[model samples]
Target: MKISIITVCYNSEATIEKTLKSVESQSYPNVEYIVVDGNSKDNTVQLIQQYNSIITKWVSEPDKGLYDAMNKGIEMATGDLVGILNSDDTFYDEMVLQQVANFHKQNNIQASVGNITQHNEEGKTVRKYSAANWNPEKLRIGFMPAHPALFIKRELFDKYGKYALDFKIGADYELITRFFLKEKISWKYSEITTTAMLIGGVSSSGYESYKLITKEIAKALNRNNISFSYTKIFLRGFWKLVSFLKKK
Candidate 1:
Protein backbone atom coordinates (compact mmCIF):
# COMPACT_ATOMS: atom_id res chain seq x y z
CA MET A 1 0.00 0.00 0.00
CA LYS A 2 1.18 3.49 -0.77
CA ILE A 3 1.15 5.59 2.41
CA SER A 4 0.87 9.35 2.19
CA ILE A 5 2.19 11.18 5.25
CA ILE A 6 0.81 14.67 5.80
CA THR A 7 2.75 17.05 8.02
CA VAL A 8 1.17 20.35 8.99
CA CYS A 9 3.62 23.03 10.07
CA TYR A 10 3.52 26.64 11.19
CA ASN A 11 6.64 28.43 12.38
CA SER A 12 8.14 25.00 12.83
CA GLU A 13 11.66 25.80 11.71
CA ALA A 14 13.12 24.66 14.99
CA THR A 15 11.88 21.07 14.82
CA ILE A 16 10.54 20.43 11.31
CA GLU A 17 13.95 19.20 10.17
CA LYS A 18 13.73 16.23 12.52
CA THR A 19 10.19 15.50 11.36
CA LEU A 20 11.23 15.58 7.72
CA LYS A 21 14.31 13.50 8.31
CA SER A 22 12.23 10.86 10.08
CA VAL A 23 9.82 10.69 7.17
CA GLU A 24 12.64 10.59 4.67
CA SER A 25 14.22 7.71 6.53
CA GLN A 26 11.09 5.57 6.27
CA SER A 27 11.82 2.14 4.83
CA TYR A 28 8.49 2.09 3.02
CA PRO A 29 9.35 2.55 -0.63
CA ASN A 30 5.96 3.71 -1.88
CA VAL A 31 5.44 6.37 0.77
CA GLU A 32 4.39 9.82 -0.43
CA TYR A 33 5.18 12.78 1.80
CA ILE A 34 3.25 16.03 1.67
CA VAL A 35 3.65 19.07 3.87
CA VAL A 36 1.30 22.02 4.33
CA ASP A 37 2.97 25.03 5.85
CA GLY A 38 1.12 28.03 7.25
CA ASN A 39 3.25 30.74 5.61
CA SER A 40 5.51 31.35 8.55
CA LYS A 41 7.53 34.51 8.95
CA ASP A 42 10.51 32.41 10.03
CA ASN A 43 12.69 30.16 7.91
CA THR A 44 10.19 27.31 8.09
CA VAL A 45 9.47 27.48 4.40
CA GLN A 46 13.13 27.60 3.54
CA LEU A 47 13.77 24.69 5.85
CA ILE A 48 11.08 22.66 4.13
CA GLN A 49 12.57 23.51 0.78
CA GLN A 50 15.68 21.57 1.75
CA TYR A 51 13.71 18.32 1.50
CA ASN A 52 12.22 19.00 -1.92
CA SER A 53 13.76 15.88 -3.34
CA ILE A 54 11.92 13.67 -0.84
CA ILE A 55 8.71 15.60 -0.19
CA THR A 56 6.20 14.70 -2.90
CA LYS A 57 4.37 18.00 -2.58
CA TRP A 58 4.49 21.00 -0.24
CA VAL A 59 2.77 24.37 0.07
CA SER A 60 3.57 27.43 2.15
CA GLU A 61 0.66 29.79 2.41
CA PRO A 62 -1.52 31.50 4.92
CA ASP A 63 -4.06 29.18 6.49
CA LYS A 64 -6.67 29.28 9.25
CA GLY A 65 -4.72 27.05 11.61
CA LEU A 66 -3.28 23.58 12.03
CA TYR A 67 -6.57 21.85 11.16
CA ASP A 68 -6.95 23.94 8.03
CA ALA A 69 -3.42 23.04 6.98
CA MET A 70 -4.17 19.37 7.59
CA ASN A 71 -7.35 19.55 5.52
CA LYS A 72 -5.34 21.02 2.68
CA GLY A 73 -2.74 18.25 2.93
CA ILE A 74 -5.48 15.59 2.86
CA GLU A 75 -6.89 17.10 -0.33
CA MET A 76 -3.45 16.94 -1.91
CA ALA A 77 -2.69 13.36 -0.95
CA THR A 78 -2.86 10.58 -3.59
CA GLY A 79 -1.69 7.52 -1.68
CA ASP A 80 -3.93 4.63 -0.60
CA LEU A 81 -3.49 5.41 3.08
CA VAL A 82 -2.97 8.72 4.90
CA GLY A 83 -1.06 9.49 8.06
CA ILE A 84 -0.72 12.82 9.79
CA LEU A 85 2.40 13.75 11.75
CA ASN A 86 2.77 17.11 13.38
CA SER A 87 5.79 19.28 12.59
CA ASP A 88 7.08 18.92 16.13
CA ASP A 89 6.67 15.12 16.04
CA THR A 90 8.39 12.26 14.25
CA PHE A 91 8.04 8.56 13.62
CA TYR A 92 9.66 6.27 16.14
CA ASP A 93 11.94 4.71 13.54
CA GLU A 94 12.49 4.12 9.83
CA MET A 95 10.33 1.01 10.02
CA VAL A 96 7.29 2.79 11.45
CA LEU A 97 5.77 3.57 8.07
CA GLN A 98 6.65 0.15 6.73
CA GLN A 99 4.85 -1.51 9.60
CA VAL A 100 1.79 0.70 9.26
CA ALA A 101 1.61 0.09 5.54
CA ASN A 102 2.03 -3.65 5.93
CA PHE A 103 -0.60 -3.75 8.67
CA HIS A 104 -3.15 -1.98 6.49
CA LYS A 105 -2.35 -4.20 3.53
CA GLN A 106 -2.66 -7.35 5.61
CA ASN A 107 -5.64 -6.47 7.80
CA ASN A 108 -7.83 -4.70 5.25
CA ILE A 109 -9.12 -2.37 7.92
CA GLN A 110 -10.29 1.22 7.51
CA ALA A 111 -7.99 2.58 10.20
CA SER A 112 -5.37 1.60 12.75
CA VAL A 113 -3.69 3.17 15.78
CA GLY A 114 -0.56 2.48 17.79
CA ASN A 115 1.27 4.39 20.49
CA ILE A 116 3.04 7.71 21.00
CA THR A 117 5.82 8.65 23.39
CA GLN A 118 5.66 12.25 24.52
CA HIS A 119 8.95 14.02 25.31
CA ASN A 120 9.69 17.06 27.40
CA GLU A 121 11.79 20.13 26.50
CA GLU A 122 14.94 18.14 27.17
CA GLY A 123 13.74 15.37 24.87
CA LYS A 124 13.27 13.04 27.81
CA THR A 125 10.34 10.66 27.81
CA VAL A 126 7.45 12.22 29.70
CA ARG A 127 4.59 9.86 29.04
CA LYS A 128 3.71 7.08 26.70
CA TYR A 129 0.18 7.39 25.29
CA SER A 130 -1.73 4.55 23.74
CA ALA A 131 -5.26 3.34 22.97
CA ALA A 132 -4.92 -0.08 24.53
CA ASN A 133 -8.25 0.11 26.38
CA TRP A 134 -10.16 2.26 23.91
CA ASN A 135 -13.59 1.00 22.89
CA PRO A 136 -16.72 2.48 21.39
CA GLU A 137 -18.17 3.09 24.84
CA LYS A 138 -14.88 4.50 26.11
CA LEU A 139 -15.01 7.17 23.41
CA ARG A 140 -18.22 8.47 24.94
CA ILE A 141 -16.21 9.33 28.02
CA GLY A 142 -13.72 11.51 26.01
CA PHE A 143 -10.97 8.92 25.48
CA MET A 144 -9.22 9.02 22.10
CA PRO A 145 -6.24 7.44 20.45
CA ALA A 146 -3.05 9.36 19.88
CA HIS A 147 -3.64 11.32 16.69
CA PRO A 148 0.01 11.20 15.62
CA ALA A 149 0.00 7.41 15.81
CA LEU A 150 -3.18 7.04 13.76
CA PHE A 151 -3.19 5.95 10.12
CA ILE A 152 -6.34 5.73 8.03
CA LYS A 153 -7.14 4.82 4.47
CA ARG A 154 -7.88 7.69 2.12
CA GLU A 155 -11.30 6.30 1.31
CA LEU A 156 -12.33 6.49 4.95
CA PHE A 157 -12.09 10.26 4.79
CA ASP A 158 -13.98 10.20 1.52
CA LYS A 159 -16.73 8.10 3.10
CA TYR A 160 -17.04 9.56 6.59
CA GLY A 161 -15.64 13.14 6.42
CA LYS A 162 -12.73 15.41 7.25
CA TYR A 163 -11.85 17.36 10.37
CA ALA A 164 -14.37 19.96 11.53
CA LEU A 165 -12.86 23.39 10.84
CA ASP A 166 -14.66 25.07 13.70
CA PHE A 167 -12.84 23.04 16.29
CA LYS A 168 -9.56 24.70 17.11
CA ILE A 169 -7.94 22.25 19.52
CA GLY A 170 -10.40 19.34 19.54
CA ALA A 171 -10.83 18.66 15.84
CA ASP A 172 -8.76 15.48 15.94
CA TYR A 173 -10.78 14.20 18.88
CA GLU A 174 -14.01 15.20 17.16
CA LEU A 175 -13.08 13.55 13.88
CA ILE A 176 -11.92 10.32 15.51
CA THR A 177 -15.02 10.22 17.72
CA ARG A 178 -17.22 10.77 14.70
CA PHE A 179 -15.50 7.90 12.92
CA PHE A 180 -15.49 5.27 15.69
CA LEU A 181 -18.79 6.18 17.35
CA LYS A 182 -21.02 7.80 14.74
CA GLU A 183 -19.81 6.21 11.52
CA LYS A 184 -18.97 2.95 13.27
CA ILE A 185 -15.82 2.25 11.31
CA SER A 186 -13.69 -0.76 12.17
CA TRP A 187 -10.21 -0.13 13.55
CA LYS A 188 -7.23 -2.18 14.61
CA TYR A 189 -4.83 -1.60 17.42
CA SER A 190 -1.11 -2.41 17.41
CA GLU A 191 0.82 -2.15 20.63
CA ILE A 192 3.91 -0.94 18.78
CA THR A 193 5.00 2.62 19.45
CA THR A 194 4.97 4.68 16.25
CA THR A 195 5.67 8.33 16.97
CA ALA A 196 7.46 10.63 19.38
CA MET A 197 5.67 13.86 20.13
CA LEU A 198 6.43 16.86 22.33
CA ILE A 199 4.60 17.85 25.45
CA GLY A 200 2.73 21.19 25.67
CA GLY A 201 0.87 20.79 22.41
CA VAL A 202 -1.68 23.34 21.34
CA SER A 203 -4.48 21.83 23.41
CA SER A 204 -2.43 21.27 26.53
CA SER A 205 -0.34 24.41 26.79
CA GLY A 206 -2.23 26.13 29.59
CA TYR A 207 -5.46 26.39 31.51
CA GLU A 208 -7.18 28.56 28.88
CA SER A 209 -6.24 26.11 26.15
CA TYR A 210 -7.62 23.29 28.26
CA LYS A 211 -10.91 25.13 28.61
CA LEU A 212 -11.10 25.67 24.87
CA ILE A 213 -10.31 22.02 24.20
CA THR A 214 -13.01 20.74 26.57
CA LYS A 215 -15.51 23.22 25.17
CA GLU A 216 -14.86 22.03 21.64
CA ILE A 217 -14.89 18.40 22.73
CA ALA A 218 -18.32 18.90 24.29
CA LYS A 219 -19.55 20.49 21.10
CA ALA A 220 -18.24 17.55 19.10
CA LEU A 221 -19.85 14.99 21.42
CA ASN A 222 -23.18 16.77 21.35
CA ARG A 223 -23.04 17.05 17.58
CA ASN A 224 -22.45 13.32 17.27
CA ASN A 225 -25.24 12.48 19.76
CA ILE A 226 -22.81 10.99 22.27
CA SER A 227 -23.39 11.40 26.01
CA PHE A 228 -21.96 14.78 26.97
CA SER A 229 -21.06 15.66 30.51
CA TYR A 230 -18.77 18.14 32.22
CA THR A 231 -17.31 15.29 34.21
CA LYS A 232 -16.01 13.71 31.08
CA ILE A 233 -14.13 16.90 30.36
CA PHE A 234 -12.88 17.02 33.93
CA LEU A 235 -11.67 13.46 33.71
CA ARG A 236 -9.56 14.32 30.68
CA GLY A 237 -8.10 17.22 32.63
CA PHE A 238 -7.38 14.92 35.52
CA TRP A 239 -5.47 12.57 33.28
CA LYS A 240 -3.38 15.44 31.93
CA LEU A 241 -2.58 16.47 35.48
CA VAL A 242 -1.53 12.95 36.35
CA SER A 243 0.59 12.66 33.24
CA PHE A 244 2.48 15.83 34.14
CA LEU A 245 2.89 14.80 37.74
CA LYS A 246 4.16 11.40 36.74
CA LYS A 247 6.63 13.03 34.41
CA LYS A 248 8.00 15.11 37.24
Candidate 2:
Protein backbone atom coordinates (compact mmCIF):
# COMPACT_ATOMS: atom_id res chain seq x y z
CA MET A 1 0.00 0.00 0.00
CA LYS A 2 1.17 3.51 -0.72
CA ILE A 3 1.58 5.69 2.37
CA SER A 4 1.66 9.47 2.23
CA ILE A 5 3.65 11.29 4.93
CA ILE A 6 3.24 15.04 5.24
CA THR A 7 5.60 17.32 7.15
CA VAL A 8 4.24 20.81 7.85
CA CYS A 9 6.84 23.39 8.77
CA TYR A 10 7.56 27.06 9.07
CA ASN A 11 10.98 28.60 10.11
CA SER A 12 12.16 25.09 10.86
CA GLU A 13 15.77 25.58 9.74
CA ALA A 14 17.16 24.43 13.06
CA THR A 15 15.60 20.93 12.84
CA ILE A 16 13.92 20.32 9.47
CA GLU A 17 16.88 18.35 8.11
CA LYS A 18 16.48 15.62 10.71
CA THR A 19 12.79 15.30 9.85
CA LEU A 20 13.63 15.15 6.14
CA LYS A 21 16.34 12.56 6.66
CA SER A 22 14.01 10.48 8.80
CA VAL A 23 11.63 10.07 5.86
CA GLU A 24 14.47 9.61 3.40
CA SER A 25 15.74 6.70 5.50
CA GLN A 26 12.40 4.90 5.65
CA SER A 27 12.55 1.27 4.55
CA TYR A 28 9.07 1.52 3.12
CA PRO A 29 9.55 2.31 -0.57
CA ASN A 30 5.98 3.40 -1.44
CA VAL A 31 5.99 6.48 0.78
CA GLU A 32 4.79 9.70 -0.84
CA TYR A 33 6.80 12.23 1.10
CA ILE A 34 5.28 15.72 0.92
CA VAL A 35 6.48 18.81 2.74
CA VAL A 36 4.38 21.96 3.20
CA ASP A 37 6.19 25.07 4.30
CA GLY A 38 4.53 28.23 5.57
CA ASN A 39 6.77 30.58 3.63
CA SER A 40 9.61 30.29 6.10
CA LYS A 41 12.10 33.14 6.37
CA ASP A 42 14.90 30.77 7.22
CA ASN A 43 16.67 28.14 5.07
CA THR A 44 14.00 25.51 5.73
CA VAL A 45 12.94 25.47 2.08
CA GLN A 46 16.56 25.28 0.95
CA LEU A 47 17.13 22.28 3.16
CA ILE A 48 14.03 20.62 1.74
CA GLN A 49 15.27 21.35 -1.78
CA GLN A 50 18.47 19.43 -1.02
CA TYR A 51 16.33 16.31 -0.56
CA ASN A 52 14.19 16.92 -3.64
CA SER A 53 14.85 13.49 -5.01
CA ILE A 54 13.29 11.82 -1.96
CA ILE A 55 10.45 14.31 -1.64
CA THR A 56 7.54 13.48 -3.96
CA LYS A 57 6.06 16.95 -3.68
CA TRP A 58 6.78 20.18 -1.75
CA VAL A 59 5.30 23.65 -1.50
CA SER A 60 6.61 26.75 0.31
CA GLU A 61 3.99 29.42 0.86
CA PRO A 62 2.10 31.37 3.50
CA ASP A 63 -0.55 29.58 5.54
CA LYS A 64 -2.97 30.27 8.36
CA GLY A 65 -1.10 28.15 10.89
CA LEU A 66 -0.04 24.61 11.68
CA TYR A 67 -3.44 22.99 11.21
CA ASP A 68 -4.07 25.02 8.08
CA ALA A 69 -0.81 23.83 6.58
CA MET A 70 -1.76 20.27 7.54
CA ASN A 71 -5.10 20.69 5.81
CA LYS A 72 -3.30 21.78 2.67
CA GLY A 73 -1.09 18.72 2.85
CA ILE A 74 -4.09 16.46 3.37
CA GLU A 75 -5.73 17.96 0.31
CA MET A 76 -2.60 17.30 -1.70
CA ALA A 77 -2.15 13.75 -0.47
CA THR A 78 -2.81 10.91 -2.96
CA GLY A 79 -1.96 7.75 -1.10
CA ASP A 80 -3.84 4.97 0.64
CA LEU A 81 -2.76 6.12 4.12
CA VAL A 82 -1.86 9.61 5.33
CA GLY A 83 0.22 10.75 8.32
CA ILE A 84 1.80 13.91 9.67
CA LEU A 85 5.36 14.33 10.90
CA ASN A 86 6.10 17.68 12.47
CA SER A 87 9.15 19.65 11.34
CA ASP A 88 10.98 18.96 14.63
CA ASP A 89 10.11 15.28 15.04
CA THR A 90 11.58 12.13 13.50
CA PHE A 91 10.41 8.56 13.17
CA TYR A 92 11.72 6.32 15.92
CA ASP A 93 13.40 4.03 13.39
CA GLU A 94 13.57 3.28 9.68
CA MET A 95 11.03 0.46 10.02
CA VAL A 96 8.17 2.56 11.51
CA LEU A 97 6.28 3.14 8.26
CA GLN A 98 6.87 -0.42 7.15
CA GLN A 99 5.46 -1.59 10.45
CA VAL A 100 2.45 0.65 10.07
CA ALA A 101 1.80 -0.68 6.57
CA ASN A 102 2.09 -4.26 7.78
CA PHE A 103 -0.33 -3.62 10.63
CA HIS A 104 -2.97 -2.12 8.40
CA LYS A 105 -2.60 -4.84 5.78
CA GLN A 106 -3.01 -7.59 8.35
CA ASN A 107 -5.78 -6.04 10.43
CA ASN A 108 -7.75 -4.32 7.62
CA ILE A 109 -8.42 -1.33 9.81
CA GLN A 110 -9.17 2.23 8.72
CA ALA A 111 -6.50 3.75 10.96
CA SER A 112 -3.52 2.82 13.11
CA VAL A 113 -2.11 4.48 16.23
CA GLY A 114 1.32 3.91 17.73
CA ASN A 115 3.56 5.23 20.48
CA ILE A 116 5.88 8.26 20.69
CA THR A 117 8.92 9.09 22.79
CA GLN A 118 9.50 12.65 23.89
CA HIS A 119 13.16 13.71 24.05
CA ASN A 120 15.01 16.58 25.65
CA GLU A 121 17.56 18.84 23.97
CA GLU A 122 20.28 16.40 25.04
CA GLY A 123 18.57 13.70 22.90
CA LYS A 124 17.54 11.66 25.94
CA THR A 125 14.08 10.13 26.10
CA VAL A 126 11.96 11.78 28.79
CA ARG A 127 8.54 10.15 28.31
CA LYS A 128 6.82 7.38 26.43
CA TYR A 129 3.32 8.26 25.13
CA SER A 130 1.55 5.05 24.35
CA ALA A 131 -1.76 4.60 22.53
CA ALA A 132 -2.21 1.07 23.83
CA ASN A 133 -4.86 2.12 26.33
CA TRP A 134 -6.47 4.84 24.29
CA ASN A 135 -10.15 4.49 23.36
CA PRO A 136 -12.94 6.72 22.23
CA GLU A 137 -14.06 7.29 25.83
CA LYS A 138 -10.68 8.76 26.77
CA LEU A 139 -11.50 11.83 24.68
CA ARG A 140 -13.62 13.07 27.59
CA ILE A 141 -10.44 13.25 29.67
CA GLY A 142 -8.45 14.92 26.90
CA PHE A 143 -6.50 11.79 25.97
CA MET A 144 -5.64 10.97 22.36
CA PRO A 145 -3.28 8.95 20.23
CA ALA A 146 -0.03 10.84 19.60
CA HIS A 147 -0.83 12.87 16.46
CA PRO A 148 2.46 12.12 14.71
CA ALA A 149 2.11 8.42 15.38
CA LEU A 150 -1.42 8.14 14.06
CA PHE A 151 -2.09 7.30 10.41
CA ILE A 152 -5.49 7.13 8.72
CA LYS A 153 -6.74 6.31 5.25
CA ARG A 154 -6.81 9.34 2.99
CA GLU A 155 -10.49 8.79 2.21
CA LEU A 156 -11.43 9.45 5.85
CA PHE A 157 -10.78 13.13 5.28
CA ASP A 158 -12.91 13.00 2.17
CA LYS A 159 -15.72 11.37 4.17
CA TYR A 160 -15.57 13.10 7.57
CA GLY A 161 -13.86 16.39 6.64
CA LYS A 162 -10.55 17.93 7.70
CA TYR A 163 -9.23 19.55 10.87
CA ALA A 164 -11.35 22.38 12.30
CA LEU A 165 -9.73 25.77 12.03
CA ASP A 166 -11.69 27.15 14.99
CA PHE A 167 -9.13 25.78 17.41
CA LYS A 168 -5.67 27.12 18.10
CA ILE A 169 -4.30 24.15 20.03
CA GLY A 170 -7.12 21.58 20.06
CA ALA A 171 -7.77 21.06 16.36
CA ASP A 172 -6.07 17.71 16.52
CA TYR A 173 -8.12 16.77 19.55
CA GLU A 174 -11.32 17.86 17.83
CA LEU A 175 -10.53 15.94 14.67
CA ILE A 176 -9.72 12.81 16.68
CA THR A 177 -12.97 13.14 18.58
CA ARG A 178 -14.95 13.53 15.41
CA PHE A 179 -13.30 10.54 13.77
CA PHE A 180 -13.10 8.01 16.64
CA LEU A 181 -16.24 9.01 18.53
CA LYS A 182 -18.83 10.79 16.46
CA GLU A 183 -18.07 8.99 13.20
CA LYS A 184 -16.86 5.72 14.76
CA ILE A 185 -13.88 5.03 12.54
CA SER A 186 -12.28 1.62 12.93
CA TRP A 187 -8.70 1.73 14.25
CA LYS A 188 -6.09 -0.54 15.81
CA TYR A 189 -3.15 0.07 18.11
CA SER A 190 0.36 -0.87 17.01
CA GLU A 191 3.02 -1.19 19.69
CA ILE A 192 5.78 0.33 17.60
CA THR A 193 7.36 3.63 18.67
CA THR A 194 6.59 5.74 15.63
CA THR A 195 7.96 9.21 16.34
CA ALA A 196 10.61 10.70 18.59
CA MET A 197 9.38 14.18 19.50
CA LEU A 198 11.22 17.13 20.97
CA ILE A 199 10.35 18.51 24.41
CA GLY A 200 8.81 21.86 23.50
CA GLY A 201 6.21 22.01 20.74
CA VAL A 202 2.94 23.89 20.55
CA SER A 203 1.15 21.52 22.95
CA SER A 204 4.11 20.49 25.12
CA SER A 205 5.29 23.89 26.30
CA GLY A 206 4.31 24.60 29.92
CA TYR A 207 1.62 25.66 32.38
CA GLU A 208 0.24 28.42 30.19
CA SER A 209 -0.12 26.04 27.26
CA TYR A 210 -1.72 23.56 29.63
CA LYS A 211 -4.40 26.11 30.46
CA LEU A 212 -4.99 26.97 26.81
CA ILE A 213 -5.23 23.34 25.72
CA THR A 214 -7.57 22.54 28.59
CA LYS A 215 -9.91 25.31 27.51
CA GLU A 216 -9.60 24.28 23.88
CA ILE A 217 -10.25 20.67 24.79
CA ALA A 218 -13.43 21.71 26.49
CA LYS A 219 -14.42 23.67 23.43
CA ALA A 220 -13.65 20.67 21.20
CA LEU A 221 -15.77 18.34 23.32
CA ASN A 222 -18.65 20.78 23.42
CA ARG A 223 -18.46 21.30 19.67
CA ASN A 224 -18.65 17.57 19.10
CA ASN A 225 -21.54 17.16 21.56
CA ILE A 226 -19.38 15.06 23.84
CA SER A 227 -20.02 15.49 27.56
CA PHE A 228 -16.92 16.63 29.42
CA SER A 229 -15.78 18.86 32.29
CA TYR A 230 -12.67 20.95 32.83
CA THR A 231 -11.99 18.98 36.02
CA LYS A 232 -11.92 15.69 34.11
CA ILE A 233 -9.63 17.19 31.47
CA PHE A 234 -7.30 18.55 34.15
CA LEU A 235 -7.22 15.10 35.70
CA ARG A 236 -5.36 13.95 32.59
CA GLY A 237 -2.34 15.72 34.02
CA PHE A 238 -1.92 12.78 36.39
CA TRP A 239 -1.58 10.48 33.36
CA LYS A 240 1.07 12.82 31.91
CA LEU A 241 2.97 12.70 35.20
CA VAL A 242 2.79 8.91 35.16
CA SER A 243 4.11 8.81 31.60
CA PHE A 244 7.07 10.99 32.57
CA LEU A 245 7.85 8.83 35.62
CA LYS A 246 7.69 5.67 33.51
CA LYS A 247 10.18 7.01 30.98
CA LYS A 248 12.32 4.39 29.32
C-alpha lDDT values of all predictions: 0.86, 0.92
lDDT of 1 at 99: 87
Per-residue lDDT over 1-248 for candidate 1, one digit per residue giving the tens place of the 0 to 100 score:
78899999888899999999998898889988999998898999998999998999999899988898898999999989899988999899889988887787779688898999999879999888877866766666667888888888888888888888988789998898889889888889977689999898887787788678778878888889988676867587687678669968
What is the model-wide C-alpha lDDT for candidate 2? 0.92
lDDT of 2 by residue, 7-43 (tens): 9999999999999999999999999999999999999
RMSD (CA, Å), candidate 2 to true, equals 1.7
User: Per-prediction TM-score, please?
Assistant: 0.93, 0.96
On the 0 to 100 scale, the lDDT of residue 74 in model 2 is: 94
**Could you tell me the lDDT of residue 244 within candidate 2?**
67
Q: Give the number of the best model, judged by lDDT.
A: 2
Error of 1 at 39 (Å): 1.1
Best by TM-score: 2
